[model samples]
Target: MGASQPGGPSLPQERRLVTAIPGPKSVELMERRNKAVARGVSTTLPVFVTRSGGGVVEDVDGNSLIDFGSGIAVTSVGNSAEAVVRRATEQLQRFTHTCFMVTPYDSYVAVAEQLNELTPGDHEKRTALFNSGAEAVENAVKIARAYTKRTAVVVFDHGYHGRTNLTMALTAKNMPYKESFGPFAPEVYRVPVAYPFRWLTGAENCADEAAAAAIDAVTKQIGAHNVAAVVIEPILGEGGFIEPAKGFLPKIVEFCRENGIVFVADEIQTGFCRTGEWFACDDEGIVPDLITTAKGIAGGLPLAAVTGRAEIMDAAHAGGLGGTYGGNPVACAAALGAIETMRAHDLNGAAQRIGEVMKGRLNTIAEKNPAIGEVRGRGAMIAIELVKPGTKEPAADYAGAIAKACHAEGLLVLTAGTYGNVLRFLPPLVMPEHLLVEGLDILEKAIAQVTA
Candidate 1:
C-alpha cells in the first residue's frame, strides 16, 4: 500500500491528530446529532468524517486517521475509486430511480447478470437485489420456503444475520441487536457452530463434533423435513470474526442437501475480496444454494443481492420479490464500478497480502501477550480474541480499552464477539503497507497500555 490509487483523493496517507479524538467541532456536531438523531443510532468514533479515500479518513477538525474498519467491510475498493465515482456520477446524471419494480432498468439486470456469472457454481442462477443485507436474507428465506414448502429455518450459534424482525430471529446476539425488539419471527431454530476457539471437545474435534451436534439438533428438534433453509455466515461478522472449523461448512451443506433444505450463505461481511477470495465459502469449495451479499458489493453504496440456483430463485411469485430501491440505477452503477475495480486491481491478491502481513504481526503480538486468546481469520478479515492471561476467560474490558486507545491515537479500529472480546481488522484492500504497519504500531501501543 504505497499511496492513493490513481485519480483517488490526494490527501496524505499518514495519520495526523490535530486535536483530541472527537475534537471541538465534532463535539458540537455530536450535540446537534443528539438533539436531532435517534438515540438508538450510535457512533463508534464520533469524529465526523469530512473526506476519506484509500486508507485515511479526514475529520472536520482536520485530523487524518488511519481507517482499519473500512466502514465495516463495505469499501473493499478505496472509497472514492475513479471507476466508482465516474460510473456513479454518470448514472446520477442520467437518472436516480424509476423503481425497478415499476419499470425495470438495464443496470439492474446487468448487476444480476454479473452476480450470476461471478458467484460460485456454474449452475444456472438468478439474482434479486435489495437495499440491505437483512432484506437479502429475508428474501432468501422467502425463496427457500417457497421452493422447499417448509416453515422452519435453521441457523447456528454466534451467527449474525441482520437486524430486522426475521433477521433478529436469525441473529444470535442478544444485547444491542436483539434486546427488547422481540416478538421476533417464529419457526427459526439455533444450533451449534464449529467455533474452534471455545469448543470444549478441542480444536481437532471441533468440526466433526459441532457438525454432528448441529445435524442432530435440526433432525431431532426442528425435524429435517420442516426446515426450509440452513442459513450461516461464511465468517461471522458482528458476532466476531469467527471462522468455523475446517470441514464444518461442507458437512452442514451436505446435510442440508440430503434433507432437501436450501443452504444459504450470508456473505455480507465476508464477500467480495474481503477474505482473499470472491467469497469465504470458496476456501472450502462450498457453493451455497443461496448466497446473500451486501457491504462490499457496491463500494459503499446501499446495495445487497441474493444469487441462487435458477429454479429456486424463480420460485417466488413475479411481484413478490422486489423493492422500490432494489438495484437503484446509481447503486447498480456503483456496483459495476466496484466489480471492475476489484478485477483491475487484483484486490483478491491484495487482501491475501494484507492478511499475510496482519496475521504475521498479530501472531507476533499474541506470542508476547497471553491476553490475546487467539489470532484468527483469513485475508483482510482478521481478529484477536482477548482473554485473561493464561486462561480462556474473556477480557471484554481490555478489548474495549485497546480500541479506545487506538482511536485516541488517530487509528480507527473495531471490536466484536459474543462475549465482546474480539478486536477485528477490515482495512480497505487498497491500503498501503506502510499505513497498515503504522496502524498496527498504534494497536500494539494501545494493547500494551491496556494489558500492562
Candidate 2:
C-alpha cells in the first residue's frame, strides 16, 4: 500500500505489470463481461480493476497501471479521496435514497448552493440536479426553451453534449455516437466552430471568421429569434480536446446576449477543476446563461447539475424539472465531499501544475515526432493531435497504435478528436508529479517506437 492520506485509503502508486496486459483473471472477467454485458457498452482498457487510488488502477491480476483518463474526467480528486469516501460512507450507513422531489434533503440544497457560488456569474443563480451529463444538458435545454419560448437550439462543430436523443441531435460526430441511431430530435441547428488547426482560412482568422460564420448561420437559418439556446463545450471533450480560438467564446456569448438566446456551457468534461479553473469559461471570462456539469461533480458518483440565473431557471413551473433520483441523498453527500476535497487540496492549482508538466514534456515530444501535429489544451485537459508526416492530414491509425502501445507498457491513455487522431490526457489532479513525468516518458517511448 502507498502512503495513506488523513482519512483516505492508500494504494500503491507505482506501475507494476504482474502479467501480460490482461492477466488470466482479467481474461476470465472479459469472458464474463462479453456474455453478460451488451456490445454497445464498450471499454477503453479491458483490464478489470480491483483497487484504484491517487494515480494508479490495480487490476485483478495485480497490474498497477497509471490512470491518465480519470474515468473520462470523473475523478478529479482521485478514485478514493479521503473526504469523498468518508462522507459517502457515512451517508450510506444512514438513509441512502429519499427522492429530493418528494422530500427535499439538506445535502441537495447545499450542493445547489455550492454550484451557484462556484459557477461563473454571481447574478443570483439557481441549480437543478440530475443523474448524468446528458440529463443535465437536456434539462438545460428545457429551461432555455421554457425561458425563451423558442424551439430551435444551436450547437457547434466538433462539439459533444451526450448520447441522449436530444443530445445526439446536438452532437457533431457521427460514427459511434450518432450512427444508425438517428431519427433525432428536431429544431436543432449545427454551425462551424473556431477550430484553429483545421480552419481552412488559417489560424490567425479562425476566432473572428468562425464566430462571424456561426453567427451568420444562426441569423440566416435559425433566425436567432427562433433559437432557444446556443449550447457549447468551452473545451470540446469527446469531439476532441479542441480549444476554440481565444476570443471566439466571448464573441458567441455576446451574440447570444444580443439575440436573447440563452448561452449554455456544457462543461461536463471541462468543469470542476478539470481545466485548471472551476470552469473552462472562466479562462475567457465568459459568463454563460446556463452551465451543465457532471463528470467530476461528485467524486465518481452519478450526479449532474444545471445551474443558471435565477430568473431563467425559475421560468419553468414548479414540477417541470426533476426526476425520482435527481438528487439522491447519497450522491449529494458524495458531491459535498468532492467539493470539500477540491477546496482543501487546491485541485484547481494542481490541474494547472499538471498542465505545465504535461505540456512541457509533450511539446518536447512533439518537436521530435512529425506525427504530432499539435499539442493544445489548458491545465490538466491536454491533447496531442497526430498527423501524417509533414502534412496536416490526420493519422488516426498512428494515434491508435500509440495508445495501444502505452496501454501495453502499463500507461493507460485515451484517444479523441472528430478524426480520431488526437491523444488526450486527463490525469487526476491528485496525481504525483513523478507519476506524470513517468507516464509522459512512457508516451515518448511509445511514440518513438511506433513512428520508427
- For each candidate in turn, give its C-alpha RMSD to the true structure in angstroms: 0.9, 1.4
Highest-scoring model, lDDT = 1
Off by over 4 Å in 1: 4-9
RMSD in Å for model 2: 1.4
Per-residue CA lDDT of model 2 for 149-171, tens digit only, reads 99999999989999999999999
Clashes of each: 2, 0
Query: Looking at candidate 2, what is the lDDT of residue 166?
Result: 99
Clashing pairs in 2: none
| Residue-by-residue lDDT tens digits, candidate 1, 1-452 | 45646224577888899999989999999999999999999888999999888899999999999999999999889888889999999999999999998887898999999999989999999999999999999999999999999999999899999999999999999989999998999999999999999999799999999999999998898799999999999899888899999999999999988989999999999999999999998999998999999999999999999999999999998898998899999999999999999998889999999999999999999999999999999999999999999999999999999999999999999999999999999999999889999999999989999998
lDDT of candidate model 2 versus the reference: 0.92
For each candidate in turn, the TM-score is: 0.99, 0.98
Q: How close is candidate 1 to the true structure, as a TM-score?
A: 0.99
